[model samples]
Target: MAQLLRQLERICGDDHVVTHPHALRTYESDGLLQYHVTPRIAVLPGTADEVREVVVACHGAGVPWVARGAGSGLSGGALPVEEGVLIVLTRLHRLLEVDLANQRVVVEPGVTNVAVSHAVAPTHFFPPDPSSQIVCSIGGNVAENSGGAHCFKYGFTTNYVTGLEVVLPDGGVVELGGKAVDLPGYDLVGAFVGSEGTLGVATKIVLRVIPRPEAVRTLVAFFDHTSEAGQTVSDIVGAGLVPGALEMMGRLSIEAAEGAVHAGYPPDAGAALIVELDGSGAECDARFDEVVSLCEQGGATGVRIAADDAERELIWKARKAAFAAIGRISPPARGARADRRALA
Candidate 1:
């Protein structure tokens, strides 16, 4: 173990290698705090080559290791393995390339999910958008195949990921896929994605982006019961209207979000749906009307359309904050995993 630590330190400077118990405690678990295991050591690699070196050293030492991104995973995917090396990849963050012509962006593993969209916001956007987008790393999303509210329309991480520069378990490095749409042979890139880090560590990623929609409309509909809202969702789809997003919140979730962000949802409503539609202005306007009619038919007690971008932002703010807002209603101890799952 001592020799392994020395080798890791040699690969990524001593300052980057962590061994202090106090510092190691922070990495014991990820967002899923229920499972915790303090790793024997943690190393922050600054570059892909450095990561390879560290991995090579660990492989030679016969030491197990795990790669961690922003540690925002809710499933303990980033939980440290006891006595193993935790390879912290945050230091590798860098937007390596942006090809507007190909609508592709190349980024390091540690880049936050939102940063990708922000980088190309003027012309294009990467659209997976998990709830934790603001803080979750792209690498973690790739590991979990994370999908957010908009994933109902834009698809998940696997849909956007085009290529990967991966460091294998045995310290060998390989490239899979690329800027092109199709690659010959096996779908290795697809397999590596959502493998939960069991395949290897992705050092760099190439992702597909799409041009911004011509128009966008957001509306909130309140129902007397959860079943009513579910029916409304079904009706909208049944009408062949593919909105960009359709998200539902039970009363508890509504109260939590309203308290956190004042999204202005009806207080007594049993359930609420945040519906978003986008595309050509004419098509969105026509479809949005049909959506409102369907919601009313499905027994919505009241319906409100976002009057402006600020209102739309606030509505989404509430949705994204729903999980953390649960604490406002429930006691800290009562905020169990089951309660969290309910919000999901």
Candidate 2:
């Protein structure tokens, strides 16, 4: 431990390398909280060069290192391996470039998922919005191949990732894809996006963006039973109308959310389906009408469409906060095995 610290201190100065137990505790777990392991050392690297140096030092000492983003992941992808170094990349957060004409945004791995959309919101969007977009990092999104409500239409993180600069396990740097598509050989970039941490660490990435839709309408359908809401989702899909997002929440989730954020929903409603349609004004209106009719057929007692921006935000907020709203559903446990347990 002392040797690793000394080596990191030499490479990035002592202040940047954290060996103190108290400070290292934060990196022990991610959002899941089920698994936790304190790393022997945690280093925050500000640049790709600094990260490569740290990886080289770990290689020289014959030690392993785990790359971490915002640690908002639920899969323990950022959980520190026993006796390994945890390389936190939050310090490397930066929006390297935004090419509006080409619809591409280059960002460091540590940049937040929401930051990408926030950067393009005034014009269009980056669209792969996980519930944790406000806190999760794009690098982690790439690693997890994350999907969210909008993914039913916009697709997953792998769909948006266009280029990546990675540092391989053997400590060699390579650029898999570039600003232009089909840069030559194999589509290595596609393979690495969801390879998690086993493949390598992504230092930088290029994301594809799209123009904002002309109109978007949110329809909230309240059903008397959970299955009714689920069937409504099926009916909506069956009608040949692909909404931007089709999310269903059960009684437990709806109750918890009502308690937390009261999005003007029926506290007694058995279930809720938040369907969103985005596209041309005519298409949105046409599809919106079909969705309402389908929900009614599926036994939805009441249906409401957001009439304005404020109403639309309220509808999405409750859905986005589903994780936190349902926290009371599980008890918090510390220092649990961060990995999956299999039965023999």
Candidate 3:
């Protein structure tokens, strides 16, 4: 262990290699707090070259190693291995390139999900917006194939990721795909995106970004029953109205979110649906009105359309905060989500 630690220190500076028990405890677990394992050491590699070198050193020493990003993942993929090397990638944070002409951006694995949208805001936006986007790293998203509130319309992380610079388990570096669409080859990129760090470590990622919508309409529908909210979603999809985002929160979920952020949720609601539509101004307006009618027909107790962007953001805040807020009411745990149809 001492020898491998020295090798890691040489690869990434002494300041970057952590060995103190207390410091290593920080990497013991990710958002999956139910499981924990204190790694023997954790290395912060500053660049792709450093990451490759650290991995190579561990490979040479035959020591097990795990890759980690922001440590915000709840899937337990980032749980440290006891007596093994912990390769922390947060130091690799960087926005490498922005090709507006190609509608793509290249970023290091450590870059936060929301940071990408902020980097390309106003004119463009990244679609997948997990609740933890502010802190979760792109590498973790690639590992977990995470979906966000907007995934119903825009798709998951796999849909936007066009290319990856990955360091294989044996410490060999490779490029899986390019910016081009549908290259004639095995779908290696697809297999790697959700491998949960078993296949390799993503050093760099190429992501597709879309033009910002001309207009967006948001609504929060309070329901007397969860079944009605589910039926509303089903009806919206059945009507060929693909909303940009459709989110549902049950009674307990709503109470937790409202208590946590006071986002103005209806106090007596049994369930709530936050539906958003985006695209051309006229299209969004028309579809949004139709969606309101669907909610009413589905037996919505009350319906509130966001008057402006400010109100829309507040609605999203409540939905996004709902996950963490649940911890206040119960033991902190990342609950499993069933298929959207399960509500119905």
lDDT of each: 0.91, 0.87, 0.91
Candidate 3 whole-model C-alpha lDDT, 0 to 1: 0.91
Candidate 1 deviant stretches above 4 angstroms: 179-181, 333-344
> In model 3, what lDDT does residue 106 have?
97
Inter-residue clash pairs, candidate 2: 35-338
* Lowest lDDT block of 10, candidate 2: 335-344
* Model 2 misplacement above 4 A: 179-184, 334-344
**Candidate 1, residues 1-344: lDDT per residue as tens digits?**
99999888888999999999989988988888668899999999999999999999999989999999989898888898899999999998899999989898999999999999999988899989988898889999999999999888999999999999999999999999884457568999899989999999999999999999999999999998999999899889988988899999999999888888887887788999999999999999988999999999999899999999999998888889988788699765433566687989
Each candidate's TM vs. the true structure?
0.94, 0.94, 0.94
Q: Mind sharing the TM-score for model 1? A: 0.94
Model 3 Cα shift for residue 162 (angstroms): 1.1
Candidate 3 lDDT by residue in tens digits, 69-173: 999888899998888989999988999999888899999999999999999988999998899999999999999999898899999999999999999878899
Write candidate 2's Cα lDDT for 46-135 as tens digits: 898888888988988889999999999888889998899998888888999999899999999999999998898788798888998998
Worst 10 residues of 3 by lDDT: 332-341
